[model samples]
Every structure is written in C-alpha cells, then in structure tokens.
Target: MVVFKKFNLDKQSIEVPGTRVQGATGHYRHASYVNGLVEHIAEAPHIKTLYDLFQNSVTKYGDREFLGHRPYNTVAQTYSGYTWQTYAQINQRVNAFGSGLMHLNEVILQNPQLNRWSLGIWALGRPEWYISEMSCNFFNLVSVALYDTLGPDAVEYIVGHAEIPVIVCSGNHVSTLLQNASQMPGLRAIISMDSLQDTVPVPGATSPAKILRAWGEEKGIKVFDFDEIENFGAEFPRKHLPPLEDEVASLCYTSGTTGQPKGAMLTHKNFVATVATNREGLSIYLPLAHIYGRVVDTNATFSGCKIGYFRGDVALLMEDIQELRPTFFPTVPRLLNRIYAKIVASTIEAPGLVGALSRHAVATKLANLEAGKGVHHPLWDRLLFNKIKMALGGRVEVLLTGSAPIAKEVLNFMRIAFCCVVTEGYGATEGMATATVTLSDEYIPGHVGCPRAGCEIKLVDVPEMNYLVTDKPYPRGEIHIRGATVFKGYFKDEKNTRDTVDSEGWLASGDIGFVDNRGCFTIIDRKKNIFKLAQGEYIAPEKIENILMARCNLIQQIYVDGNSLESTLVTVVVPEPETFLPFANAITGSQVGLGDNVGLAKLCRNPQVNAAFLKELDKAGQAGGLRGFEFVKRMHLTTDAFTVENGMMTPTFKVRRPQVSAHFREQVQAMYADIHASTPAAKL
Candidate 1:
C-alpha cells in the first residue's frame, strides 16, 4: 500500500461520516479517498495493462452495451438510426481485427526491405475508429491518431514524420490524403471507413469496389473498405491476447503552438496508471484525437460504464444528452461558459412573474450555497432547479470541466444550478490528461484540487517573475510533477524530451501556480506566456483574458497581446452579438439590425463605440482585481469568432496565440503606431 502524505483541514481535524479527511499534519499530497483507490488498484494482480482492464470489464459485464453512436445523414440533417454494441460483441470485433492486423504484419515481415510498420486512423466518433485503435493495441502496432480537422499540410507532415504505412480514414480525410499522396512515400494502403461510392464518386459512378480499384491503381496504393478487413479476420479464429507492459501504445501529436506538432509517446503502462486513478461514468464528447478524450474513453471502458457518443454535429449535443441521460458529463470551459451565458440571458429576459421567480430562485440558491447550506430549497427545486436539471438530462450526478480555467462565478453557478458535484481538473498532453482533479466535496472556486493519487507535486521558485514558494499565506512557484501517468517522452525528439523531463524524473509543467492552506492548486499564469512591459511590470495575458471573458458579457472571445517594448496591452476582441448589438444601437441612437456583418464591422471601428468598449474593459479589469499593466489600453473588435478552420483556435479549443497575432498583424501594428504617435490611449 502507498503511504500518502497528510494535510490538516484544521488544527484539529474532525472526520464526518461518509467523508474522508487528510491527516492533521497538513503534509498529505493527495486526497485520502484517491489514495485508497490507488492503493487498491496497485494491489490488484489482474489489472496490469489497458488490455487487461478491458478483459476484466468484459468478464464482468459481457452483455451490457459498451459503446453507442447516433447515425445520421450529414447533408440532410436527418437521423437515420442509433447503434450499440455489447461488451461481448465488441470483444469479438476487436479480437478479429487484432488477428487480421497480425496477418498483415506477417505479410510485411516477409519482405526483406521493410523494417517498420504502423497504422493511422483519422475519423470522428464512430465504431470503426474505436475498433482500429483497439486492434493496434492487441497487435502491438503503434497507433497514430490523426485529427480530422488537420489541414493537408499538417496531415502530410504528421504522416511522413510518423512513417505510417496504412491509414484507415473517413471520406473527407481520404480526399485530403489523396491530395498529398505524392509527398508521403511511406504510405502503402488506404482503407475507407465509409463506402467509396458515397465518399468519392463520379457522376454516373460505378460500384464502390470498382471506383476504389481504379483510384488505387492510379495512386499505386492498395485500397479496401472497412468491412473487407473484418471479413478477412473472420476467416480465422481469434488469436490469443497477451498482456503488454511498458510498450509504446499510441503516438498522440500535440497541438503545435510553437511550430510543427510533435508526437507524444504514451506507453501502455502510462495509460493503465491513468485509468486506474479515474472514476467511472463519463459522456465522452471531446474528440478522441485529444488526450483528454482518450483518457476518458479508456477509463470509462475499464470501469464498465456505458459510453455514449454525440451526433456528429456539436450543435445537437443537448439533444444527445437528453436521449442518453448520462450520469456524468466531461466538458471544457468554453461550453460551460456559453451555457451559463445563455441561461443567464434567458432568465433575465423571461417575461413577467416567470422571470421574477427565476431570478429570485437563482439569487436564493446562490446565497444558500455560499453560506454552506443545502443547494435545493423545496419551492425553488420544483419551480426552477428541477427544470434546469431536466435541461441537462436530469440524471447528471457530476460535471467535470477542464482544458482551461473557468470563471469562479460560472463554477459556483454550475454547482448550484445543477445541484451536482462540478469538478475542475488540471492536465496537459504530457501528463496523460490529468495531474490534479477536484474532489466531490471540495469545490473551491478557482483551485484544481490536490495532486492526484500516485502523483507528487512540488513548486520551484522563479524569482525572475517574483513568484516564490516562501510567499506568505500561500506558496507560489512553477509546478513540477513526477508520476506514473506522465508520458514516456516526445517521439524521436530526444533534445526536447530531455529539456522537458529533468534528471530527477520531474516534468516541468511550464505552468505557474500556488498552493493554498487546503493543499489545492490555483494556476496563476504560464511561464512562457508571461511578458514584461517597458514599465517593468510583468503581465500574464491568459490570466487577464480569462478574467475579461468571464466578467464582461459583451466580450465573447479575446486575445491579449503585449511586448517588452510596450508598457500597455492591446487586444483583439470577438464581441457577443446579442450584448454588443444592443449597446451599439444605444450609442448610435439607431437600431443596428442583426446579421449585418458590414454594419457590425463599421461599428467595431467607430471611435465612439471603441471608447465605450474601453470603459467596459476598465470595469471588467476592476471587477477582476487586475494590475495596472493588465488593463487593455487599445483594442480591435472583430465580428468573426476564432475557429479551427480559420487557424485561430486549436481542435481542443485553445486560442492559438501566434496564429491570432499574425492574422491581426495590421490591426496590432496600427494600435502600437497610434500609441507611438502620441495619440492618447483609450481612457480606462
């Protein structure tokens, strides 16, 4: 059993029934219950690898539905049907697929010239994607996940760098790969998940097999349908599955914020450890290409929880939620913020007594929650909170949000509104999706709870930025993590890997945060993102950006940029349409109609409107307790929301700073030039 460090909740720690307490010495690094679970997992002899976990789950729940997906026509926007596979059924497919892959490997090994072979998958949340991934695991072939949103260039770079021999992809991805096939010399075969005729067909097209045959002949690469491989495997009985130890399992590429993306090498042991520390029951909506989604899927599968996939369209997520009524929902801050904004808007704008009662209920519930009282009042629970719960499918027991820091108000509102435990975790691609997760009972606003089980965390002082562990009340510094869940290293990048993971086996997170009395961590800023201004004050743009977007209703999205040469900050703002339109109309004394892109663009550049927006920024800054240098001094408002297609946001929804900066290069230059020309900055 692992002996965990202890922390004192108070000088005299008292244990309540059904609640575990950290030690009285105030030294425990992990939650008590989490430590118990980790120790239990460590002691279990059968749970050694991810495959082992899956086998165990199959043994326990063979007849239960393991995976589910909604089938719909993309163009028609009509639901065709729904499909589910039981654990036993899925096991049969995985075994057959694994055997087929082994057969393919045998063929490759017979060649004298070939030394390495791997497979890639680029598709959405479909059964084929899951089967392919599992088959790779069973056959000991390295699985490379290709994001569906990746452009042709990025896809080529990743495919060539990884030297992928076979690719199983959807129709759109097939077209992308075909465009750059000449650039990828290592690619051998292409398997279409959908019918080739439906995916890529000529007018008066022939059969899918013939079309694929013709295309394959032209490209000099073999092409097959998804069913062909399965059928090939079905000719033989399932092969004996073996447990894998520390072998490299998957190569998940990082979202390239600096330059080209690097593949992170995640081993089977790393995944087993991560899943061992996880709780069950999560509705997986995040793309599987992301580490966050992968961890959730693995954990849910291992824990024998029924996993549900959303319809391809994200706009229809609520519909899926209502249909599935999942017990837990894993989400990111972006979606939660939008939900909060919409609910607040609807409540305030509701007509007559209905709106008044809604407002009163929210206010009462919030007040009670702050005072450490029950969240549900009998009257309010029926009239307001119950309806709110129904909207979230009515069965949500816990809501987990991560990938970014949510506003404290939004966090608190979610807890009260849903009357469920809302947890916020901190993780990165390097850490296998989680380092710290908030406990159910410990719902501090901005703090991601204690270090996870089997993970040891320590802070190193960065005096240059004035962060120190010896600070009063709370100790602050750069967080370094050491754990089994950390990735092995960056694939084939020894120098970068050495720089990331130190000689002491500690991975420098590059994130600066502080620990409070309860051993909870509150992230302040990122070390790389911190910039010093000409006036000698350091500014963390992400910290300020979160504050602004969380507090200001008119601001939908923002990118705060500053340089060492400039004393003040500048921002590119994507305004909230509903909020900005009304505000703009009041200023112009004329109704600005909705969907008027040209008029909105002109309004964004108007001097009077800009001045008012500056005041709004000042108000938001004051509300967030921001420093003087943290306030936005100049701004450019755009009607366009940053999206993945525009190269402004990552697939995981993180703002791409360099890309956004480059796209708005002219506006940024003009903002700086105005300041240099002695044009007074917007009055804050």
Candidate 2:
C-alpha cells in the first residue's frame, strides 16, 4: 500500500456497516481498478503519482503537444511543436535553479518571518508559473500564488505573510512589484516571464516572453528562457527532490480570517487524493491551475493521461482547444454560462424563429435522453451545433463546471449548442473535489451529482448555536466530508484546523447540502453565510443570490446582509456591463447611463427594476423552496462589484465574507438610518 509520512493510511480507511443505507442508491458502478483488487485495495498515493504520470506521458504521447500557448495576438504556440526532449531539457534547467537553492534551509528554520523563503508567483494565467511551481517543489520551497488582480494590500499580505524571498512575476505584475519592492522585506529577486519595457505600465504585462527578456538584460541576475530552463533541468540531478506528499508544498490564502492571511497547508498526499478523485470522477484530461484543474491534472498525471497546458487567455484557450482539442475541460460555471450566453446570443436572433428552435432543440434532446435513447445527435450538427462548437474553439467532448452554481437555462443551452455532456462537481480547497455529476446527457439542473469513490458522507445535527438550526432532516446543515481527499491541516493554525475537521475525521465543508434518496447531492447555501433577523428567522443568501442571478443575467454578484438586524435586508449588487445593457435600453427606450453611474441612481429609481427584483423574491418564497421567514424584505441594490484589489473578494473570486461584511456594513446600516430619519418616531 502506498503511504505518506504524516497521514496514516489505516486510520483513514472507510468501513461500512456491511449494509447500504436506505436512502443511498448506487451512484456509480465500481471501476475496474477497485473491483480487480477487492481483497488488496491499495492505499491511494499522492504527488509521487503526479511525477510518475508525467514520466509516462513523456514516453507515450512524446511528440503530442503537452503544454501549448499563443503569446502574440496572431500566432499559435505549443510544447509539442518542439520535442519531448525539449520539455525534459526545460525541467532540467529549472531544476538546476531549484537544486542550487535546496540547501537554503533558512525558510523552515525561521518559522513565520517576513523573509523566510516562501515563493511568490504573480500572473493572471500563464504556464511559466506552473513551471516555476515544479521547480519550487524540487527545492522544498512552499509556493504562494497571488492574483494579478490583487492591489497593493493583497500583494502586501501575501508577500508579508509568506515572507517570500523569490517572486516570479509575469509582464503584468513586475512594474507593480518594482514600485512596491520596498514594502516586501525578503524579496531578493524578481523573475519576469516577458521583458519589461522602458516605460513601465502601472500594471505590468503578464506575458512570459517579455518578463524573460527583461530578466536577461538585467545586471547581476541570471535569466533563462522557458525552453532554456528545460535544457538546464537535463543536467540537474534528481537527488534533490523535495519531501513527498506529507510535506507542505503550497500555502493558499483563504478569506474569513480577521486581518492576516491564513495559509492552508496542502500536503502532496492531500493534493494527490484530490487529483485521483477528480480523475475517477471526470474520465478526461483537464488543464491544471485552478483547484479544479489542479485536482484533475493530478489525477490525469497519475493515470498516465497527458495534460495540455493553455496560456491563460480565452483566445489562447480557444486556439489551444482547436489544436490540442482537450477532451475534458475543467471550467468555472461563469465561463460556461458566458460561453452559453455568447452562443445563444450570436446564433439565435429572432425570438419566434431561431430562438424557439434553439429552445426546442435543447428540450427535445433532454427529453429523448430521459427516455434512454442514448449518445446520438443528428448529422445536421454542421448547420446547428457546429457554429456553437466553433465559438467554444470547436472540439470539446465534455465540459465540467464548478466554482459556482450554473443556471439551468445556461446548462440546457450548452447541451443543445454542443450536443455534448456538461457535468458539474463541488468541493473546496480543504477537501479537493469530492463529488461530480455523472457523464450522462440526462442532467438535472442544480444537482452536483454523486460522491467520488471511497467517500462517505452523513448529515450531522448542527450545534444549537450553529449556522443551520432547521429541524428538518438533512435540511441544509454543514456538509461533512470523509475521504482520502481531505486536506491535512492549515499550517501553524492548529485550533482553526482542528475545528474544521471533527474527531471522527469528517471535514466540515461549511456548505449546507443534502443528499436525496437517489444519492444525488445539491448544495443549498453556505452555513457560515447564514444570517439571522431580529425576529430570530435565518436566511441563506446564496439561494436569494441564485434567484436574482437567474432572473437577470446582468447582476454578476450579490451580497445580502441583515442576519443580526430586524426590519430590512440590504444587498450589494455588481452588474455585468454586457448583459445589463440591452435590458436597461428596453426599459428606458433609450441608451442608459447606468453604465458609468457608480451611484446606481437609475437602477434604484426605476420601477421596472424594482418589480423584477420583487418578482424573483416572491417566486423564491412561493415556490416553497425556502422558508417564508427567509424571504427578503426591503433591499437596496448597488452597481459596484467586489473585487480582490478592493479587498472584498479572494483571488479565487469567492466573496471574502468578513471583508465584504465589513466593507458594506456602512451601506447596509445607512439604509436603516434613512428609514429612521424619514419616520416621525425619530422626532419623538
């Protein structure tokens, strides 16, 4: 059996009562790997598996494009366009740098100082950062990913918290890093992917080529091209491989902490299990970067599946897809919905003709699949689905969505547009990804599907002072997870980490969800996000957020706050410029200025807008999907969006609950102040 240093394999095994639960049904047929080893079910290995998979692919699809990109506007780029030997060479070059620093044990020795040897990588989306991560792992350094969107404060937090000695920034982030260099204490060197220009832009370019060019010309510092770095790896010995799975490989900062950043210590094993689960769950190669991709990449590498890296722009992603044609896409719900919206908006114009046709086409396909006529779509795809496919950069077989909830309409539209299966899964950084929808076209809207192999779930009673206090069974308590995919713990914060996982080893997801009799799971909202009214009624904002988002595509994000208050619930709204424009024009019969109106004066004064909001609110209550007490009362909407730079959101685009609450607390309180000032009771 495979084993890591800290996590005991035997202690984490799953043993049932030898009887299946009454409500839990067969979600999946046991795969051959498990069925073949009934008596000798092996322990799941971790990051070593990732290394092994890459080695295998280095032999198998050696000439195939491993990582591809298009840096410039017109041309396409690729790893396979070179050679497998070239990739190996790049690894060697990067490893040399890592090996040179392997003996620098200064980071581990100095607990949590400002310059203790953590790595800071800044790039919105690029492959060089991934290459840098591999090098850091080779040297036993912890890699900290900072968002390019992060303004000075976020940059300061990560740089200050990790005490990052070396920072690898793309063209986009180098200028900012240079300007703010004095703030970070331990930053000895900055590596850029693309070359820096004479006149530095406020936000530097994130392009790899420009950073490298700049680094090469700099004095007293060594710079290597990506391919040249690969060459260096060829000469570096592999003896300096960092400690495996049990060792902390990366520190990811999560929101909800008071001021300082809370680093989540993800071991090689924790990441490995997550990758394994993602592989078994989705059956294809997914890009690596985001947590979903990270898990999928692990699984793919472990299973000898080849991963094709795309330089992080949608145009490049599309180009890579047409060239690489990745069978599996690990994407966020927003991206999928955006793709759907784009396809529908472009292809179907007249409401009575093409629009109705598109709708019917999607509904019919779904209805046919429900009847068990499987895996067949008409040849007229050239006229119908081809254009849609082209819009997605053409060749996608399966698309996996997560990171947020997807609208059912968007899902349906994609199903018809591509004539392919679109599945979804859910989990967090703490647990990797534990559940995924089945690879069938008969998809149920809003369902996250089944748990992965070897995962056991249960509904536990919330503490009387808990987030969810509903008496209903499995009625939206925190979703607890138990599996090999559960993370080890957060680094240095034992109390918070221990509080997250129970004595029985169940990882508290903090998400409120329930499993149906058929074993399918649906997330209702977040337990931590629940707020109570003065009347003692609780409301889950996600449900309301979803309802509003579904009603109007214009609202990108919504935050409802009023749990501890009595009379009214106030909301902060971030409107999508593209989606909101047409609707605004429809109501005004002229071009709307809500575009640059930061005050949202037009939106607040418009009765049509208020009516639409109320319509969604009433539907949510009367649909009986929510408690009557959970209904939202008077609300105020704003057009300003919360972002990482503004300190309202994390790098992953999740709303920083405490930050958001604190930032908008003034606005929320102001509504009540306006109410009291207008009333005669205030005079009394």
RMSD of each: 12.5, 13.7
lDDT string for model 1 (328-355, tens) is 7887765676567667666744889878
Q: Which model scores highest in lDDT? A: 1
- Compose the digit string of candidate 2's lDDT tens values, residues 303-415: 44445555566544545555555555667654564455456554464367787776666566667655655434675365566766765556566676765666676666676
Pick out the ten consecutive residues of candidate 1 with the lowest summed lDDT.
283-292
Error of 1 at 516 (Å): 0.6
Whole-model alpha-carbon lDDT for candidate 1: 0.72
Candidate 1 has which clashing residue pairs, if any? 5-28, 6-27, 6-28, 7-26, 7-28, 8-26
Which candidate number maximizes TM-score? Answer: 1
